[model samples]
Target: MTYRKKLIEVALPLDTINKESAREKSIRHGHPSTLHLWWARRPLAACRAVLFASLVDDPSNDLPEEEAKVERDRLFGILEDLVKWENSNDENVLGRAQAEIMRSTGNNPPPVLDPFCGGGSIPLEAQRLGLEAHGSDLNPVAVLITKALIEIPPKFAGKPPVNPESRGKIGNEGNWRGARGLAEDVRYYGKWMRDEAEKRIGHLYPKGPNGETVIAWLWARTVRCPNPACSAAMPLVSSFWLSKKTAKKAWVEPVVDREKKEVRFTVMTGEGAPRDGTVNRQGATCLVCDTTVPFSHVRAEGRAKHMEQKLMAVVAEDERGRKYITPTEQHVVFANKAKPSWRPEAELYGKAAVNVPLYGLTTFADLFTNRQLVALDTFSDLVSEARKEVYKDA
Candidate 1:
């Protein structure tokens, strides 16, 4: 049987589906796509509509004009039900729609395949419409996401996902099945990982000066002064403001001590207009030797000729949204012990036709500070430990 209903005829109803899908996207409370941020994802409604239209036979086909009109109305009714099922996640309606498609296609619809499934939207929609779906992507992150969306859930459908921490205890909470136990295990392990990470390096992430919990910390790249006579290094940050709040504004100002040949960072706070001079987007001038330093001199420029300095997260924001920038003298004192030697994932290439050495960032690890690395490593190790403890036999 061939589909005889023109796609344009169903465009009106599809418009309704599109709008509802857009609304769902804005507040996706339990959507599977929210698990990971994927680039250039397609709309699920469009995927569903395309898959349904392709797989099912058009109702107006192989009928008299009078009967075709009746069939057309019935088809629209089914489309309305499909849209309703998609919005409400009603499996029964979905099953009935799938059965209708199977009947139309003589139960011989081919399994759908998406080779460049960045976020598995098409494959997921195909599966929702009761079609066997397969997806693949060059990106490992995308592959993992597609597997989680299209492979894992169905494989462990009836089975409860119980990690080691909640395996035995979940039974006491009454008939914990399917994803419920899995969610419990996730939450339990999540808290455990955080606690373990904090226990190891909590001191490094200091609270805000206002006695509020620290929300975020900002770091900057540092480089040594080119002048050999005054070999002083400083953080090459453009701006030091942690908050742009009109009344609660705060920023860091560099106090250059020409006599001592060093720069001191002071955190100034009050209700005042933003000082344009406070932000130095250009390369910083050396405080001691009165030498102009460009960004190229501080970054990884050539073979073993790059400036050496530790990365420090010197600025922080509190839970109350107050800003606090660390004093340069006090913070830089810890620099000697805070050396981070994390390597790059891959060598960065420059756009220049000439082959430049160490043109840009080389590794992912080189981007973070010592304390951040420590925290990340600790958290990673704890996750591995938790997994091993939970799934030792499996």
Candidate 2:
């Protein structure tokens, strides 16, 4: 058998491919990154180009050097078109690339396999080129994201919107091609889930004092001061800086009251946020008695259930985009009242991820507040219920 090189073994127009790959991570419309967070997501554009190059020959079939150069340049032109994010769904562009693959493999192109698939980039690209795509992974989350991407879409490609509201609006406006119908249903039912959730647990998240919608709550993990004379609730905040935007600079400043033995947090804006934080790997500094608190003491407090969380600041959306404010009594009250039924309890790994277990946040659920747990459990339930609704509509 004569040895013949593929385009992957030859020129690949790499610089153009790299530019396209880098742009895929941006928050542009309809990117797969918007679908889910998978740290191992490969660049779909790079996957598309490489998969095609792997299959198609490089015109190395004993042609004259000049003729081979011409043919190679032609394939480079096709790859430039194929590797584009905009041309991903361009049928003419994809059809030409697939045709070349068929021509090379004698119309019996082998199915693509991604044995370690994370976020389904490779198989998704394989399916883009009209090839049978199979993906598998040990991580269940990866498997779920991959299955949602590769298994579901093609099954109903070119189908019309099934939901009644979408059908009512999509009346006589041509077929709902690709995943347009499905995407519309997603928008519709995603809104439904959100509305339903608000009705159930809307009060858990309250508006700020001035009636601004609360965007976030900055929390500080706390342990009692090691100094027996001071014994104040000392905060374990890594950073007090909330926002560094020149116009909206914000941070939490701790106010120590000597007479009351209390540490109250104040939300401050503009020039003077504290230069240093409360805690680092070695230890923390108690603001009250000026005692150096050791990490070992913090761990002891956590083990003894003496550690607590304090509301450092309230982030709210206002006319000015965002504003940091001191936490209101009402906001703190609502947070403690949440009674969620279920929580995931998984032990932490020391060297694998973070040393959280040392601080007695032993399980995954222990890391979140009760209100946060309620929201998580609510969203998880709604997803299941929403799936049933999609099925009924389908």
Count of backbone clashes, every candidate in sequence: 2, 0
Clashes (candidate 1): 2
lDDT of 2 at 191: 87
Question: Which candidate number would show the highest TM-score if scored against the true structure?
Answer: 2
Q: For each candidate, what TM-score against the reference?
A: 0.66, 0.86
Candidate 2 segments exceeding 4 Å error = 28-33, 60-65, 170-174, 207-215, 243-251, 266-273, 314-330, 345-354, 391-394
Give lDDT: candidate 1, residue 306.
55
Clashing pairs in 2: none
1-394: candidate 1 lDDT, tens digit per residue: 4335653344436666677667667776556667788998876766776777676665556677678668766765666667642443576777776886787777987899999999998998888887889999998999999998778776665565566555566464566544455566556767777787777666565454555565554554456677878867655655555567777777766667866766666667786532333215565666557577665665443234454443333455454444565644434444334543443345444453133444344446555556567666676678789887567623
Write down the lDDT of every candidate, Cα atoms only: 0.63, 0.86
Model 2 clash tally? 0
Candidate 1, TM-score vs. the true structure? Answer: 0.66
